[model samples]
Target: MPLSTRQSVIIALIVASAYFMENLDATVIATALPHMAATFGVTPVGLSIGMTAYLLAIAVFIPISGWVADRFGQRSVFGGAIVVFTGASVLCGLSNGLVEFTVARILQGVGGAMMVPVGRLAVLRSTEKHHLMRSIAYITWPGLAAPVVGPALGGFISTYFSWRWIFLLNVPIGLLGLALTATFIPNYRASTHRPFDVSGFVLSGVALICLMYGMELVGQLHSDWRITVAALTCGAGAAALAIRHLGRAAHPLIDLSPWRIPTFRVTLDGGSLYVVSVSVSPFLLPLLFQLGFGLNSFAAGLLVLAYAAGNLGMKSVTTPILKRFGYRNVMIVNGLLTAATIAMCSLISPSTPRVLITLVLLIGGLCRSMQFTGINTLAFADVPPARMSSASTFFSMVQQMTIGLGIAFGAIALHAAVLVHGNHAQLSLADFRVAFLLVAVLVLISVLYFIGIEPDAGREVSGHTRTASR
Candidate 1:
């Protein structure tokens, strides 16, 4: 029997909460870094290991998440992951040394790698086609809001309380997530499981690890460019090998068949490119405000609140908008608007009115919310039920990679601007202008991919009525 509407909504919310917890944890640590370094008796730069460790862990483990869930059961793996993550959070809070903290973060990543993809798989298996958009909307906001909100929230908690509270805060949320997962989540497994693809796993894992580590290197303000290039090159080579191997393997670690589906292919290609462009904002905005606009970190963080408001503002109306406009029209139009807003950031100067900046961010947030929800929901609109596991896993992996790429893209753009102008010790307003324009261009490139989408594609889920051709 299909899950009732009420049950479906409940499961979606529970999964959303778990996603929120994971995202918040990932970003919340930034503001608390200084305090953490003080406690650990190390430089702030040294603590980057903790952040990189978590990311690398997630990248290495995500490819196998689907296989593990199928080998076990979704509910069993999901609940166990929660336990592991929660326990690791406690360990993070208690750590007095960098090694201990980094290890704890890796453990947390392992749990998170399994938690989200499997939970999403369960949701897709249970939700009716009509409900997919709303279900995706429910889950999308937390990921969007967490990055915007995390810095301010972390600053507040770190200033008034101990930095340890940052990790410890996850305790209650994780505990509640555990209860919900065990009670409501179904234990799904493959009826006929394939043997593990050990070779495929090795190739994919190396590719992701190198790619992520390379991006991490690029994002750092002071890193060896030589090492970054080498890491990225190795990642690309390994990725090519992984793709070739998966195509030939009898029981591939990740099923590449989803790429043959038009809707799913669009999401993997166009949607990922869009993500790379959009991801640049979070990395760039704070630097723009602090370095370019002469604003304090607090004021800069406050400005992002407008963006977050726009995200929440659109949440209630996304379903209606999609139903009215359909995915193809909505994504192409909204994506352009999103790029326009991003480009507008280049116009902000010290003298630019804060209100105008706020308005721009608000509009950008709205467009981002709609475009992301549409792309995500539509990816699965045409996927078969049996392929949900592999589809979700592949999508999750791409999402993670693109996010890392976004940050790297922003950092590299800023670096290039610096080189183009006379090399300076500190970045200037003109540097930001160049960077924003470049990021905007990245977004525009994605539109070419979006243009390939079929006119009536994803109409089934969006509920958009197609008019007959005259």
Candidate 2:
């Protein structure tokens, strides 16, 4: 039987809660990493493996999420995912060694890999076309909160309580979500005619894993040349294999034809560059605070709160700005603004006032929000309804991959700065200044991708409003 309106609302809330928790887990470890390292007796690089393991697991399993959701029902996959994720979180907290924690993180990643895409798919399939965007907007609000709230929350728990509490917090929320899903979420099965596309799946997974691993290795540039060369070769070869598989498959996992769309291509190019540049800050800022400026975890967490404030503050106005100026203009101008704000971070120093640093981060966060809003909206604006599912999957995959790469690149930049300045033990105020400047330059270069977009291109603001109203 079809669900009632009340049931649907409950289901949406359940999924949103799960979604928020899943994403929150991804970054909650950042502020707690120092403590986790101390507890595990590992170096920064070794502790970073916790993040790497999670990301690699997610990337490897993402391609199969859609298939699993189709083979089983959405409710089954989503509910089961919540249980697995929650259980894994408990194990992660209980872990006594680095290897054990890494294994638990991978298991958590496996559950997360299923939770998001399937939940989104359920919401999409359940809602009417007119109500679709609104439903998605509601579901996505929790996700926006994750980045804003995660650092502060994680820091408070890790500092006041224990790092274990960070993972333990997921338990109650997951249980509630699971109960809601079991009660309200409907089962959805795949069409019999749709083939699994095994070859495409394998090749695509290999390609993504290699590329992400290669990017991670790039951070260890001082490592053995043989290791670097091997990773690069594997990444390149896997990419070639995926491309070949895409050409031959009857039903390719990702339809590369979308790249042929000029607007789609431009949006992706601009978005990727923008994410790579902006995504690095979250990972870099905490380390800088502790090592460079000698701030405590609580204080550093507050600075991150400022970034979230700017992001949330801009949410209301960002869409309107895109509508008024159109995607091309908004992206081009805002992209520059984002880069300039990040570059301004270079001015940060131990001698710099806290108020000034916070103000700079606030501006950067606002611009980052605008840039992401514009790019994401424009990327999908031209996609036909028939291709929406594939487009969404592809977009999500790229977003995740880029975020991982961004952090890796930031690590590389910081490591290089430390090497150049001959400061090995602790990062200095000067090291952060140089690293921020380098990332800011990279952000500036991203503006070139948006240059391809015409001012008149993309749906107009009035049109979107009219459609929404109807």
Candidate 3:
């Protein structure tokens, strides 16, 4: 049965809430690293294992999500995912050592890998064509807002309360999501099922894990460049092999047919650029404040509030903007502005007025929100209903891979600047400037892709008609 409007709304809300819990769990650890390290008796960098393990686990499992959900009912898998994630969160909060925590994180990743992609699949299946833009916008906020505010929120909690609360807080949210899922989310499975592609899963998992972990390696300032290069090379090769196999295999784990769709293809290309570039700001901005401007953790996190505020502040107007300007125009213009705003950071230094900095970040956030909404809305507009699950899985995998790539690229930019300038000591403002400029250039490349999008693209989803004046 096609979902009624109220039912669709419930599904979107339930899925968004679940994703918020998942994303918040993934991101909130950013600011609590110091406290966690102290308690675990390790360097701050050493604690990254917890984060990387979770990411690698997610990347490894995400490719199989669609198939798994199709084999089992979505309701069963979704509920199980929440249970696993929530239980893992509790275990993470209780961990006393790095090994224990890393293990728990991987378990959490198993749940999250299933949780996010399947939830998205549910929304795509339930939402009507006309309401896709709003449903997509609803789901996207948790993905954006959680990461944006996670550092600040984490810093506050760790400073005043305990880092344990970061994970423990998920219990209630997860319970609520689980309850709502049972009441509101419908069970769905593919009618025609094929044998599981164990080899494909193996190859894709290896590719994603190596790529993401390699990036994590690149981020470590003191790591061996040789190992980093090797891991990245292997990741590239495995990815190539995986793609070839998926394209050729009759029962491939990941169905790649959806990439043939022009709208989906272009959105992926353009979205990758935005993801890689913006990925830097979150990791870089807090550091720039702390290392360059000499702000403490609490103050640095608070400073990032401007960026987070900017990220969320534009949400209310995104739908209207897309409706008025259309997806293509908004993406090209808004994406360019977002990139430009990132480059504008080069102008910020110790002497820059605080208010001016906040204003710039606020504007940047607004631009980014609009760009993401346009891309996400337009992505699924042309996808066939039968292929929705496959499209969701492929899209999620791409997002995971590119975000990992962005982090690595951000790390490399900083490392490159440090090496070039012979700043063998502390990172100076000059290093951050180099990183920002390079990443911004990467973002500008996305505009070239966006230019190729046809006029009146995604009109049905955005309600933008060719006859109407902007």
Candidate 4:
């Protein structure tokens, strides 16, 4: 039976609500970090544990979401995730100590890990191919709004109300999401059953955890040789184990064979690096404004609002650019633009006009939006529907892991510069300028990955006709 328009809208709203909560939870903590640190009697580095715990939990559980959805049913899984996430938010708000907060965040991450991809999958399963783009556009709107609103909302609540309010706000939103999901989302189960790959799952989880932890540790240790060596060793060993396990397994949790496809491989590599570049800015920008520029929490939050505004404004232009230039051209050019904007951020100084800084952030946000849309769309453009599940899981995992690593890297860089300058107590504005420049250079290196893309790789995405003779 054909569904009514209202039913479709309701389903989309349910999914978007879940996505908004997930994205908001990811960034809302940024503005609250200092307050969280003071309350827990920890340093900036210590507060990172909160972010790390959530990220690590998401990384570990992402692969299992698909399996669970297939086993139980999408509607059940989706509804249950909302419950877990909302309950965890309550726990997070109620926690007093760092350990308790971290634990609650882990639970939140588990729920979050399930929420997004599963919700998206639900939308896709319900919508026809012709309407897929519109459905995706609708789902993406909340995600765009989350980052824009997260900083200001977090700052306002943490400053006047308390950091706990940030988490508490999710209660009402989650409840609404739950009700919608139960009412609108259809139950879905896989027809062809594949045995659960227990061994593969364990190895992949171990590998991801080790890699993320190592990258995070590298950021924390900076120039500390011993710590860097230890982290690298563990990370390398875990990666090797995962590779070997996947090669032999009948049904690996994550099939690395996708990497053999040149297009998929190039896209994933570039996407991972692109994510790393974009992810670091949000984490570092708040600290730069509040600590270095001497802005109050609310003012710093407002600056972040500029970045989000740019992101929102750029979305309308993204598809047209991709259509005109094609994916390879779009990615290559936008990647360079993103790198240039990031480099421009390094030029910020205490005496720099607020208008100039805002412009830089705005341009950076626009370029980043283009970069993200291009990368995400191109990553799956060539993927056949049968492999969509694995591809989705792989893409989601890389994106989340890179985001965590990027933030960790930014923090480490800032801390190292401060330590080297022998000014830990007073991190000067100049120090932050140097850190932004360093990250910009790192972002520049990511452009090379986009350069390797095949010119013809994304033709279908741009609506160009393929010549049968070719």
- By TM-score, who's the top model here? 1
By descending lDDT, how would the candidates be arranged? Answer: 1, 3, 4, 2
Give the runs in model 3 whose Cα sits over 4 Å from its true position: none
Candidate 2 to native Cα RMSD, angstroms: 3.9
> C-alpha displacement of 85 in model 4, angstroms?
0.7
Best by lDDT: 1
In model 2, what lDDT does residue 468 have? 37
Query: Which of candidates 1 and 2 is the stronger one according to TM-score?
Result: 1
**Colliding pairs, model 2:** none
Error of 2 at 241 (Å): 1.0
CA deviation > 4 Å runs, candidate 2: 1-16, 33-47, 97-99, 123-152, 182-189, 220-225, 415-427, 454-470
If scored against the real structure, what TM-score would every candidate get?
Answer: 0.98, 0.85, 0.97, 0.87
- Where in model 4 is the C-alpha error above 4 Å? 1-13, 33-49, 96-100, 123-151, 221-228, 415-426, 464-470
lDDT of 1 by residue, 1-470 (tens): 24878888888898898888888888888878999999999988889789889988889999999999899988899899889999999999999999999999999999889987987887887789888888888988988888888887888889898989988988998999889888888887888888999999999999999999999899887889899999999999999999999999999999999989999999889999999988888888988998888887778889988888888889999988888777788888988998899999999898988899999999999998988898889899899988899999999999999999999999989989999997669999999999999988888888888888888888888888666221
**Model 4: lDDT to the true structure:** 0.76
**lDDT tens string, model 3, 1-470?**
34998888889888888888888877899879999999999998889889888888899999999999999978889899999999999999999999999999999999999988999899888888788887887788788778778888998999899999999999998898899999988898989997999889989988998898788888888888899899989999999999999999999999999889999999998888888888778888888999999999778877777877776778778877788888888888887898889899988998999999999888987887777778787889999988888899999999988877887788889989899899979899999999999988988999999999988899988888766634
Q: What is the lDDT of candidate 2?
A: 0.76
Q: After superposition, how far is residue 369 of candidate 2 from its true place, in Å?
A: 1.7
What C-alpha lDDT, on a 0 to 100 scale, does residue 245 get in candidate 3?
A: 94
- In model 1, residue pairs whose N, Cα or C atoms come closer than 3 Å (at least 3 residues apart or on different chains), thus clashing, are none
